[model samples]
Target: ILDYFELTKVDKEGKMLNIYLQEKNIAPDGHQHQDLESKGFFPEVEIQDFPIRGQKVALCIKRRRWTIKKTGEIISRDWGLIRKGARMTTEFGLFLKGIFG
Candidate 1:
């Protein structure tokens, strides 16, 4: 999909474009958590937030699957682009902030 969309060069080493840091683990309200519980685990895990432009922002969420590795490691991998408005990016960052900080 990256190739077809040409989001990055063909010889790029990895798909990661940027990594952000967040400080808290904000679980979706109980109802939403229950809905996705069967599909995956959404534990209240927290991490350190990154300082950007002199302001602290949310942390990176390393999504992990429990069935494969019990020791705790991010397992799921997904990447995509939403071409609409910069607002989307800002909104996403804000969402992450709400979830983490």
Candidate 2:
């Protein structure tokens, strides 16, 4: 899960911590093909994470894009880090549910 993203930056706003991460540039099929071209990044997404030292943490993920030279098809990695219908990570969501469910 952590291998898919690279830590880009970290910012602290008052009691909140913002972590910026950029998805690694690799083929969506999990292969490093020579025909792949680097494209722009997708819109940034924010997901809440477990707090640290009583400070809320937010993950700002930037998903990269690529175009296949052979087919001209744009593709990107589908990282299912966030749980369905929730803005927090799957691990964090499960932790909260276990404590309060």
Candidate 3:
């Protein structure tokens, strides 16, 4: 799932490290087709990640959208990288659980 994101930029603001990523061109239906056209990007979502050098790290991910030329259906890949009901990566959530639970 992490491989879906391509590292684009990185920023450091005080005690926070922000990592910007762009989602790779992945077929929503799990099969590549010629009818898919680049539509745009979804709203940026921030998900907390493991701290680095005592600085809070967050991943700003931008998921891509596509439009099917034949049907004009908007499609986007639903990558379940974040934990349920939490603005954090699944791996980070599991790490916290291991420490606190």
- Angstrom error at residue 17, model 1: 18
Provide the clash count, candidate 3.
0
Q: Can you write out model 2's per-residue Cα lDDT over 1-101, one digit (the tens) per residue?
A: 56777998999999999999988765676547548987989999999999999999999999889888888888777777899999999999999999999
For candidate 3, give the lDDT of residue 94. Answer: 92
Better of 2 and 3 by lDDT: 3
lDDT of each: 0.33, 0.88, 0.89
Candidate order (TM-score): 3, 2, 1
Candidate 3 lDDT, 1-101, residue by residue in tens: 55677999999999999999998887776648547988889999999999999999999999999988988888898777999999999999999999999
Name the candidate that leads on lDDT.
3
With candidate 3 superimposed using the best TM-score fit, by how many Å does residue 43's alpha carbon deviate from the native? 0.7
Model 3 pairs in collision: none
Model 2: how far residue 100 lies from native, Å: 1.5
- Best to worst by lDDT, what's the order? 3, 2, 1
Given candidate 1, what's the lDDT at residue 11?
A: 23
Give the TM-scores of the predictions, in the order they appear: 0.23, 0.90, 0.91
